[model samples]
Target chain A: MSSVSFKDFRTSAARAIADVRLQSAIDGATLTFRTGRVKALADLPDVDGLRDQLKAIRSATLARLADHLEMFEQQARAAGSHVYWARDAAEANRFVLDIAQQHGAKLAVKSKSMATEEIHLNAELQNAGITPVETDLGEWIIQLAGEPPSHIIGPALHKTREQVAELFSREVGRTLPPDDIPMLTAEARRLLREQFLAADIGISGANIGVAETGSVVLVTNEGNGRLVTSAPPVHIAIMGIEKIAPTWDDAAVWLALLARSSTGQPMSCYTTAITGPARDGDPDGPREVYIVLLDNGRADLVGSDYDEILQCIRCGACLNACPVYQEVGGHSYGVPYSGPVGAVLMPLLYGLAENEALPHASSLCGACLDVCPARIDLPRLLLKLRAEEVREHMLTPQERLLENAVAFVLRHPRLYRALTGLGRIFQRPLARGGLLRLPRRLNPAGERQLPALAKRSFRSMWNEIKDGQL
Target chain B: MITARDDILKRSKQRARAAGDHPPAWRSRRQFDDLSRRFVDSLAAVHGEACVVPSLEAAFARLGDLLAEIGAGRVVVNDEPPFSGVDMAARWPDIEWHVAGRSAGDLRAFCAAADVGLSSADAALAETGTLVVTSGPGRSRLVTLLVSVHIALVPVSRLTADLFTWTAGRSTPPPAMITLISGPSKTADIEQVMAIGVHGPKRFIVILYGDED
Candidate 1:
């Protein structure tokens, strides 16, 4: 929604990041999530085996995605529901807007959903002259501030309690105190409750779509997602094409992993699996439930080298484990996503042209890959994106030429070794010890420190080798 | 106002089920070993707790032994198989085992009633330190939520290295809900200060169940 990815990372972060915020906000948030994942996974040391299984599962599922989709459609239809496929963002927006217009709806409530963010659903609905409210506290905060989410789980992670108090006071025309989470929460509840009672339409994002049952799985810490889907008659669930899983059991594992990874909760507050509207004698449920499967280039991904990308659960664990993301925050990636997965996914989902710099944003720490429950090879995908960006010539001319030269030299191991040796010898002045102080190529390297290289090249020393080195 | 609200609710259900095509048949779990490997590699990176014992008896014995050694008095247990053998009251007359199932109260209360919480997993991954639990008639989502010390028993048959392999198919085996427990509840909320069991369980004990138990 901000559409300001080009503002440069530092400039944007400096403008947004609050100084002297809660250490728990950073440490507590990251560690709680990290530890929950640890406890949940104490028995399975063979996650690689699981990753393999997941890979096989995703491939098989995606392979027959169309078939399964057809089955899910039939099942969903049989159970009395509607499924809409959006080729891209426009189609999704049009569908939602048209639905709102048809219902003559003026009020709408939404839960936290990345797919809606992908399609910019709120703006579209607004453009069509309808009010779409984000009911999640985090999304609500950011919505008021007019910024994209900094963290997937905590959309308003960028905001401090003080900032929230200020925002809330202003929004509600009341003087609210800063610092207490409950009081602030109470204020928010009072406000959103009014909307919930008044809204005619509710929107949500599905955690997992069970094809067999034609059920949409929704996991949430707060009760907002449930209310958004249950209270309003018109419930539109926007989910990515990849969120579909085989059955209830698989959705459970992902659900088990999701909240633990995202918020360190053993389980979220609510897990709603709505198959059709309400059962005939059901006391509560929406009258209508629409599932929008947005392709938005995912169909292409299913057939590409990045097919593993489809296995992503969007748990936000990758971002939390990401050092670069911790430092620069989500906005720095200049996309809806801002961590390692974001670096790779945004470029792929959106395109190289829009997010070329994101792939190179990480240190290739492999932390994202390490923490991913789905176990997507994030770094490999990252490298591939960088390479593809070059292949596509998305980089500036100078950057392209430089990148090409590096690639050419790297292709020939012998030449690369020779060039590095020669450069090290000739560039001794730039090297203090084992480290190169500055390459001199980076004019503004003052902000960054250069790494020192090994004194004597390992290959050269090894050629005049010593056997039984130990 | 209420009339329009009801109409929207009526319409939204129709929207959720309108399908482009039929839903595919559910797929079965395949390639267990490969799935386990990937799962372990991923968990090892996060520094999650993992233990692979040879037998269920050994795992439970190890669990009970550890609890006794720690002086933990009462215990709570989920209704998973192989749990019947863990006679906590017989071993430690002071120890109590609260049945973990639906109609459970606040997680803290359930956890407070017992010193140690033991749960039998729906599935287990040998590669990663994870216990998968599914929602059922008896199992409450809270059994895994509130305990200070949580113990999970995993069967070898469910073990896998790859997380992807299990996720491949359309059909997930019985157990409507599946949950994966890796280690004790942990939090790093305080200045990156790693604290175990901030909100849930502080101590995490695992039992890797095999043929014997």
Candidate 2:
């Protein structure tokens, strides 16, 4: 919330994950999402082939994305839809803000969108005196609590229903019983129904944007996304630059994988393909529609190692699958994006100089890389971020000192050999049988027995104690 | 406001002309099918679906008695093939019948209007009891989606092993929305209760028929 950049947002997310409550939350979410996804995709073997096809399609689409944008603009224009290109978050926010102000939208119903979250849209609108209402149950819960989303799909995964009951009781001005889920659903629904009916402008994010047709694809289990987009006469869709697919078929391929992977549903309850503003004789759809294509540092990724990051569909499958994210939730990432995808992406999109700690939040466990639907090499990018941090001299002085001291001790062969010889003598008291029981003060593993050195150094024993090996 | 967007687009057009479009190498379904076996093997190795049934009739018989047992009435039918034959007025005179058409009511109005729904499959996969339907008949998307208990009439010929057969741009053409339905709509977003048809159809029954055997 302060000027302190996300780069300073350092936490031992890997170590902190050992906490029982935190581990239980992450373990529950990750395994549930992962197992459900595995089941959903299990019935369709062609889905993997489709994923391969999409990998090529996504890479190809990202490569000449500027051209795709042009084609999409032409198609959308031809269909009587307005398209705006925003070079940054501010530009994107201003574009939508202007549209909302023009409509005099007293109540704006918004579906859950990480893109809008990234731009701080709700706050921006409130500052301008327009009420931005979050329609997703998880998002609405988070909004009322005055917090950001912690999970990609389930925004309010951080809070229990009991906590929700208290929050609702205060807002609804009644002591809503939280003994059961039906009460929770009824309480939330009673509140949102009013907002949906009153809202004049509706905003949403696209799962995949079809360039050939200039349609926005949205997959949601809750029908709020559909209601918001259609019930309101003025509908605005804010999408990241990388959301484009050359055609609808490509979009379908990704949609099939997305729904099955994200929530393990055969497909989302609603998969709406909105092409343009309403036409004559068309019944009950937004009369005025605007599509804001946001760059937000995506253009900078065009020719860089992080370019693979653009293949993401914003499904949040990586977050659900990442062990670290399951424990700390999304807020600990201290950015709009989170989890394995966020580790590589937050630095690139939000400015690496301010988000270096994001990359260090992972275990390099490679489980995230394994589960990514887009197959972005998350571990590789995290290592790349670490390298960048070391180059920038952004690491704390203590870490620098430790690394320097270790390097100095190891650089000289004589000193290294002599130190090992001396360490063996000093460690005799701590040695039990063949294992060294390290002193707790010096080593965290002290209580646990550590493997002792061989009877003789490798140089004096079996041959070849190579330099890199040591 | 419209004029400003048009002007910005006009300028963007000039800069955009310099870039090239990216298109991946796409092969015909015939070519893809030959290699598709290998493709399915890889997917099966990673995330395998449960055992597959080749006949839709087998799936239907398993579901038909179940639907009768549930005491569902007021059968609704979407405007599509195979199911276009199920007559609501003639079959059960006492039970109300609704057909999805231009005059078909909207989701909220009709979802509660029907207790049972009949739909025709756009395509069926032998590898799974999955039914694929497109939006040519708008009723197919909404009725199958909104009905409480839905029944699908699947022609055995439409069942294929490879998904590319349907997704690789169909030549005969069906409708606007291509929906591949494997099972009934289920959700776990609220307390992870596996609720069926919270927003879509709660139950699915497939009437698969083949001629030769």
Candidate 3:
């Protein structure tokens, strides 16, 4: 939404890495989520079995997503909800704007939704002269700070308590203590409650869309998800096309694993299933319900080599387990979805040209694959994206030439050995304590040093040993 | 537009893997011998309180004590079975009482302003200490959501083994809304520190009655 180029990643990541407070926040938050996920899964009985079952369901549903989408549209319409299809972000935002304008809506309350963020709905609404109030605590903080979410689940994990207190105090026009978290929470609750009561429309993101029941299930620990869906006269749920779970049984498996993977809870405090608007005899809930299905380049990936990326549930476990994410933090990704999932999906969804650097952000450590509840092979996807980038000539000219030279050397063993021997002889002056310290301008790795080539080539040593010569 | 829908479906049909048979059946097994005991212990683990009573009369007696202890001056109760027969207005004559679906005042506002909201749990899961309440004619969604403290009366017969079992036994068509509440509303958004009572009820108390004295 903010329009960032991958070329800026190095600068942005360096800035983020240099912030001590940010490093502390990132380290503390990710460690907590990682350890909590481990303990929560270990406490459950047959956690792996449930994950396997969920994966099977996800794969099966994706294979027949079109049929499931038809069923969902039919069932949702039968249950009195209007279903709309948006080919891209603009169409989706236009539908939401039309609904808000039709009702003369002035203020709209939003629950935390990565779909909404992905569509850049807030800026669109603001430009349209309608105020969109984010109700999630972390989201609200970042909204007030005029920044995008830094984490998929915790939108403001980048902000410290002192920073939050400062933000809240500015809003309340009074100084509040930084250490009093409960007081800050109460202040936020009191402030958002007014917006909830007076808003004309509510917008949310669906965690899962059930085709058989025509229900959209949302899971949240805070009650904002419920309030956003319940308090307003009209409610709109924007969901990715890949979020379909065809049956109630499939939904049960998702519910079982979603909270456990994301927040390490047996279940989030609330798991709400809304089939449609308030029924005939219901006293509360929105009168109008709409679900906007957003395609936005995902359909192209449906049958592509990376279709398994569709199985991702946005649990943020991969983010917590990612080494790159832990070091550079989420803001460096420049998208709402970050870490291993971002490295793969950002290029696939946005385009490889814009995010060519993202695929290289990982070390292919495979830690993300180990923690993913959906078991998405993020490392494999990253490698595939990198290969595509190279094949498409997306690399810089210098990089292309370097790659060509390396390939040429690798093909001819004699040239490689001769060059290495020459490099060992030529690098005596630049080699400092076995590390090649290149100037910042020439060094592609920036601050990091390269290990100097071995003084004696391995091939020569192997040959000498085979000949019984020391 | 229909064209967008058609295009998306076309791409999906062309690209998606062949659909497999319906997913393997839900196979979660409940380990606890006494589901009610397991439910109580599970509920306690999530900062919720649960008590077992012999009959509806005993539960009502305990309910009265809880109301007095909470100093509930204003209360909202759902007009569903069991709760509909409690005669809350007559029992607590002085409190501003509102019964959902049968009250004179605005039910949503009353639930929001009331100190305690009461409802009957249609069913519950013992494994996760979850209470499933569906929105229908008499059950208002806000009764348990908007109050400071929520008290639900559960019958032991309505307890299920877990979510898997609950879905396996679900026979009727799905309601307009089904809420599965496991604990009091909570958030860890601020520095990943757990905070309670962000928007929903702060205290969740369940009265599991009508079996095994």
Candidate 4:
């Protein structure tokens, strides 16, 4: 795995919240996705039942993942595809590099795949002197801007039209209008068409790998997935070990829910299934096909308490439905996978100590669970991580002391009352109207104002009312 | 040293739990009284054009009119059923037609510059207005993918209620490649603005013929 700098969530979230343009962009994109999901799910005849069916399929698949994988390997090999296993990112990258070297490939066109992003494959290819081109419009935009993807489905969601126009103008050596989205898209199509045709290898991430036929399925709205898999002579697909569908029946359920949850479309424009390399007498398609099953910390998660996290299909509904994610955006999570899924996943994939702030990023909102097609209890997992953090003593000394003091006071009502009395006296100077305006240096609430203490305690009021004193 | 495959498999097996019974196959309750109308409406909802014709001959006539309307100079087609025996070059002598796997002179080159790509769908879904195309001896994946305009002739008999119905009805293993095309290629990556034909066909047309040749 490529080492990403651990920018604490507080710092990045604060920075993101302050950017007005980014805030609106995040708000607009997430709302669109969230609303689309609601409407799309409503259109289904038995969405709840469908969700349950998908969940059961995922659980059953993960339960016997090793056996399914072996079966998949046999079937895929029988179908003339070479299957390789990578225990970690290093192994996966090495396998890809060897393939490129063996083929003497110079250019590789890629469709959007988060698994590749997780392993940072492009950088590895770049170091080995092979040019990697991102063919997805969002991914391509971010690639040109030299930035990490902020959204899983829409990698360039954080960028505005004006910013994209600037990037395209610089690339084409001409000033393009910022508001003309069609013209910008056309420019991208014209430029990327050349790369697609000239590329020697094509790399994609498998959305689902079917064990029945040893097929790798790719879902995309644009036809780039088809072109990438078809245009190149050598096609390589890298998938996480957990992304397996035992049969076509299971794959059907997955496909039915994936698009509806992610983009609110009944179905994406294209869902391509590649069984193996091109068949005999086939006029087009790659001659050689490779499916690299990547573990990269996934196998270790199989039977753990966090095993349910492995059931994630990467639909990204949790991100759109998350309150914290909507406000701060994906970059605030400080990893490729962000939002509620990232909060629980990054800490487990990496060490909890290194990503200590992630588990605390959520407000324990269950919106993610409600919208999740797989119904992974993200908030529960987040709580579990928080408990683990406390158990491991990851909190700072001051925070520990504050927690201890608060616990002690809550245990004794008399002590709490006394402290409240003292606090009311001390807070008189800061109280303005109904809000408390603490000094800038002492305020921990940031932009939000604290509520002033009540003039009389609720206990006292209750006692007076009980005595019939109006 | 154990190979990466063996080591990973061991670790996974050690943690593997007992496999439970697989869930029963889900059947869609959505029944379309008229599959063709539903298919047309669903396809149109996603910016795709669709029409129902009484017979295959009428469908061919409609396709000819579409070709004439677009003023297509070059056309690439898949040599599958319904199109295999037809003499496209003789029927339309004014335009250049490249029949995949049959009369092919650089199919890829023709597809790249072709005005329209023509094929027949193996099956279609009424729920989402999707066409499922499979690649085989004569079917090229790019025929329906690479052109600016794509025209698919789907028989009403191949229409299923939805994806669930299609999956449950399948008796054979899938081909080398199977694609479900719902609409013209589109993107909302740029400021959430919808742009059509970023990489694939800008226009997708479906002609549903009722009668078999």
Candidate 5:
């Protein structure tokens, strides 16, 4: 993943906030998802109990993830699947490319897989002279526009109907109406169907890798996942080492909560579990199956402070519930994973120094925890990352100086009171209706005014009451 | 140089924490007074069609009616249990029948060009209105996936309370592939607007019938 600096986040977030079309699209999509999630969870008999059960399952699985992964590899090999372990993205991408090259594949169809996005596999495929077609409608839209996904579940939620129509019109070399969403969707289906049939290889990500049966579970509302895994002669699935379930029973619970939290569905339209390639008598299915287990810094996080992030099923419920994500949209995070999860995961995966701004992206609001099916304490993780940043001296010298000075004044109540009294007098010229209308050049809080100092201090009122001078 | 697998395993082991006790199995309290009614209502909520009939003969008649109602000329059927040994071509002589794995022509080609794909569910979940289908000797995965419309004949006896009940009761090894389909293929990808039949069946129909005594 390319490193997005703090400056980049500021620039892009400002641009996203100013884009009216993008703002409305994000708002409408997130609001609908939030409302749907509430209704769906309300229907559950014991949602809190289910969430606790899920958290236990995930934490326990992670506690001995290596054992489960080894068991999975053994079972998958028994089922005739070739399992390859990749230490990082380069190795994973190289393995996939080698498979494509060995098969002389020209076109590779892919389902929506964040693991692939994390490894930047499409560009590698393109560079190797193979065409990678994203089969998911949302992923395809972003792929066409040459942009990263703004949201995990709804990749094109930042786009309006008019923008999508424009992109589709360009692709087909014809004029298309923006309002006719069905026609647009039908056109995509007609076009992608050919790619599914003609593609020589298929690639996907596993939502859950069951250790007991050596199965890779894929949950999708569209049938692209089914086609991508079924049509091609060779299928490759890349997954993080942490996406493992110890048993079929455990996977069932994971599946029960995954769709409900992600899209408010009782179950996704298609939940296909591929154990291996087609059986002997099976007339049609993939001929070869390859499972690439990607470590990619995930193993190092096992016992770390951020290990709970590995429990994320990537349902993206936190993304829908985050206030910062709702305002700036997902592109500001500048990663495949976005929202609160991205804010914490990116910094940990990449480095604290590299993704400094992301840890501070949140207002520390605990909405993500409330909606998380796994009940990951995202706010606590963010705080930990921030503290790590401070401990490691990731902050700039100026920031460090400012923080120290503020700390000093806060420690000295007399100085703090004197400064506040002076601040009130100095703010008389700029103060207007409880806000300080500072000049644009002098204002650091752009587009928003800072709250003015109160007319009198609380200490002054306390002293007045104490002296019976109300 | 160490192998990626060996290195990853070493690192994971080095950082491994003590394994916590496994949580107890979750038993769902979701029970329906009428499984068939809940099945129909739940399926209908997701824009799927379901009807409970009296017997296998009625179910077959309903399937024929659906094929005729859609004016489907080409139909593909999976040669699985209950569907096997049933000569669909003779029963529906007007429709072009392609029995997967037993049919002479290419199954993929037949399904791709077919108007409706038909199969029998291995099991059904009433809570979510899901049909569980597995791929094996006579069952083809594409039979229910590639076509525009998919119709399944499910015995009411196969219906369970939900996924919890289904998984807990399984005694046999899973097949090469197992799919739990809850509704017709749909997407809300573009501008968050719902559109049906993106890559799979536009309409999913379930015919539930009483088990033969």
Candidate 6:
């Protein structure tokens, strides 16, 4: 899940922006998700009220998360599931690997799961000599291509049909046309079906865990979630500690909003709530079930200012609505969680010093807040992260000096005006056609033209107008 | 690991010291006068087929017609309350049959190779046209999944107003797996193009019968 450094955010974003295909894919997919979100929310009667209710549920649940977790563990264990608590990514991966080794699982089929991706479980499983086959078409495509998912819901959104065709053709040892989408889907189904049937263990991530019933809810449009859990002898579900609801009542509201918010559907085709392993007389399902409650840096954020970050349901709605995310795509964030959420989370979950630039990746447009089902205050958190960065003296020396100078100038009107005047005079050397064309080394914006400041200051213009010199 | 669990929970409790208690909100309910009609309409909207039959005989007829339409020769049926009295194998002797826990074969292999899976809904939601099927003593999850077509026999009496209504009134512990099948398996993952029947059933047909008591 680790990629290019967040300190190199500008370089990564610039590279993504320069790729026409990446831009087009991001534009097209984000637009679809954005419009779809609008329509889906509009169809509901009083969506704002629903969003508020969901927020309250999330807030109330998190306030007493330990209680809920304990309850879930008791109930899940009673229902024949082994619940493991992992302090961090390494522990979580180790538990999964142990399960795989215990079952002698040479092949493991996986459904689309961001939690698994966040921990880089596939790489660990591969190192342990288990072929972790991704069953979700988008995840499978990216897995085959040796690339990370560019979108949360639509993992292969960055890849074009022609590229997919090439990938499929290579797998099948034959040439295939790009335009035949159904055929491509058929090919995936045929290949993944075999993995599903033969795999000894299946791994998935929980969308939400219900404490009342000890059920882990998984929503999927494709049936891979079902196949994964049902086909294997052992099923392992990894869930972030935050993904919990106290009761079935809370799970209901989450299910109601999740599909609509993400994919514009009233509900996804399948919403399975698995309490434990298969029952005694049940025909098919995993014999052993394991629930790994992952608390990787989340336990510390329980009552922090950024605690609301845990409210995110991984809908990818915020990603679609973010202007910066739409421009540079998910990979630019350099984390499994991307977009506005990633900006705030990556810095907090990882160290702020290592990922200092992520919090500033946003334009603070608040489009994310508008469409967020949980109504998480993302922009406010981003601001808090930025303030923390400044407080910790994490910014570069040049950036700090520039910020201090600007702050000082803004404090005194005379100094601000004088500095502006001097800047307008000094900028002439690099100013051309009403834009600043600074040398490549000196230009911070890099490839983007900066509009030259007006010849007259707004304050001076206002003063002149007041003197009746119109 | 246990020590980690204790430490994590301990920190979480300390941090949550300032949080106030909030009682769970009672969700406002949605009402539908004709729930069965709404159920059918909702199911149709999501590419699922649903029909209201006047009697059990009519439901059986509809199921037979659906099977014939899908050209399903080998069917796996769940042995539950709704399917108990019906000797499906005796009625359709020509078609191969495998009943959960009753059939003499490997249930997984039978389901994976079967053309149709038959089960009965424990409950359903009118608002979303979702059939709630649970795995228990006589029921098999694979009887609904791992087939080309899935036929669910849902009685009208089992219909609830919506998801909230059903969840709010829950009295017993959940089964091993409670599946809410809204429609046939689908995916728009590939360039946002909708493709049906990815891994589960391609066709989901609901036979709604047995009027409310």
Model 6, runs deviating above 4 Å: A1-7, A428-447
Report residue A93 deviation for candidate 6 (angstroms): 1.3
Alpha-carbon deviation at A47 in model 6, angstroms: 1.9
Docking band of candidate 2: incorrect
Best model number under DockQ: 5
- Indicate the worst ten consecutive residues by lDDT in candidate 4 chain A: A1-10
Q: What is the C-alpha DockQ of each candidate?
A: 0.04, 0.14, 0.76, 0.83, 0.85, 0.71
Candidate 5 C-alpha lDDT tens digits along A1-470: 65667787877777777888888898899998888888878877888988898999999998898889999999898888999999999999999999999999999999999999999999999999999999999999999999999998999898888989999999889999999999999999988999999999999999999998889999999999899889999999998999999988899889988988988888999999998899999878999999999999999999888899999999999999999998789988877878999998888777778888998889898999999999999999999999998999989999999999999999999999999999999999999899989786543326657889999998999999999999
The per-model lDDT (C-alpha) reads: 0.64, 0.66, 0.88, 0.91, 0.91, 0.87
TM-scores for the candidates: 0.66, 0.75, 0.96, 0.98, 0.98, 0.96
lDDT ranking, high to low: 5, 4, 3, 6, 2, 1
Model 4 error, position A256 (Å): 0.7
Native contacts recovered by candidate 6, as a share?
0.73
lDDT (10s digit) by residue, model 1, range A72-184: 66677776778887777887888788778888899999988988988788888888778989888778888998988777776776677777888889988987887556567
Worst 10 residues of 5 chain A by lDDT: A440-449
Pairs of residues clashing in candidate 3:
none
Report lDDT (Cα) of residue B94, candidate 4. 99
The segments of candidate 3 whose C-alpha lies over 4 angstroms from its true place after superposition are A1-6, A425-438, A442-470
Rate residue A111 of model 3 by lDDT: 91
- What is the C-alpha local distance difference test score of candidate 2? 0.66
- DockQ value of candidate 1: 0.04
Candidate 5 segments exceeding 4 Å error: A438-446
lDDT, candidate 2, B62-137, per-residue tens: 4455456766566666655544554546544665566666345563345445777776765664433455655443
Clashes of each: 130, 8, 0, 0, 0, 0
- Better by DockQ, candidate 4 or 1: 4
Off by over 4 Å in 2: A1-19, A39-50, A168-179, A186-194, A420-470, B1-163, B170-186, B196-213
